[model samples]
Target: MTATGSATLHIDAPRQRVRAVLLDALSLPSWNPAFVSLAGPAVVALGTAYRITVRPGLKGTLAYEAMDLDMVRMAWQVPGFAETGDWRLVASGDRTLVHHDFTHAGPIAAVLRQAYEGVAELRLGRLAQVLHS
Candidate 1:
């Protein structure tokens, strides 16, 4: 965890609904362009390791567990990189506010950190659209 970034998104959906979709790793590709596929249990459980393929054939494994209120605290390992992140959901009236914070430290940490910051907003926007729908 050498670099850190955070993004917050507000979705017009119930907190539970948003949390459900977020935890559904199998459905990730339907909403997230970065994800090509995910192989894991129907529901994410603590200590359950999952494999993920992102765009351009990048692959990784993530074993995440819930912290509280459906928040996911995960550590992922890619080919030459590693990162940890936390995804939290909070109710805002009838809607939900999603907060994601991640940190990565590796040989190319600076480059990835900059890239993450640049695309974080767009990624969150896609997530919002999916959550709303």
Candidate 2:
């Protein structure tokens, strides 16, 4: 948790729907950044470690650390980096205010600091597209 970045997205969907999308590990590539593939349980479970390919060659390990109606948190590690990703959901009528934030430690985290904002925007944009579809 040496470096951090966050982005908020308003999706025209209920919190339940938005929460489902966030926990769908197998479908994350459709919106998540640098996420090439997932190799583990199709359904995420707390403490169930899974392997993921950040790119075609780069790999990582991730697990669901916490989950509830309002937020889902994950613990991720790749090479010299370790991170906690939190997707906080706020419900407003028929919409969900998704505040995505991540704190990371290690060299990789520091290196990504300069590009974190752009990356977050890219990911959130893709997510919005998917939810809208």
Candidate 3:
């Protein structure tokens, strides 16, 4: 079975600014605690690949590759995993609404769903702060 989750955050910044921050993979560890580091080629367009190391538990790291970045639509996918998601950016006035939808598969889908939601909220909060500042 698979589980799906979606979250949105309204950022007090222009769509371009929000997208810039989100695509800056190198700066991820600066604001996100779960990300240890990002390795691989530079970010291009959709299908560009990058490696990421994320903390899965107390002392383990889960390595995965991310690809398919639709910069124009502000969307992407984290391939090579049982989960896939897309980030949609909607510009409203001077702010941008970031909508994220993710689906997880496998037996640990429930646990991953909870973890992803919590992580997404935290990341969104951090992104909002950075954009506002």
Candidate closest to the true structure, highest TM-score:
2
| Counted clashes in each candidate structure | 0, 0, 1
- Residue pairs in steric clash, candidate 2? none
lDDT of 1 by residue, 66-124 (tens): 64675867777767677777878889999888888878877656566667774556656
> Which candidate gets the maximum lDDT versus the true structure?
2
| Clash list (residue pairs), candidate 3 | 47-68
Per-prediction TM-score, please? 0.84, 0.90, 0.68
Comparing 1 and 3 by TM-score, which wins? Answer: 1
Model 2 alpha-carbon drift over 4 Å, by segment: none
lDDT of 3 at 5: 69
Candidate 3: how many backbone clashes? 1
In order, candidate lDDTs are 0.75, 0.81, 0.60
| Model 1 error, position 16 (Å) | 0.2
Q: lDDT per residue, candidate 2, 1-133, as tens digits? A: 3877788988898899888888888888667757787778887899998888785467888899888999999887888778788888999999988888888898877877776765555666777787889
- Order the candidate numbers by lDDT, best to worst: 2, 1, 3
Clashes of 1: 0
TM-score of 2: 0.90
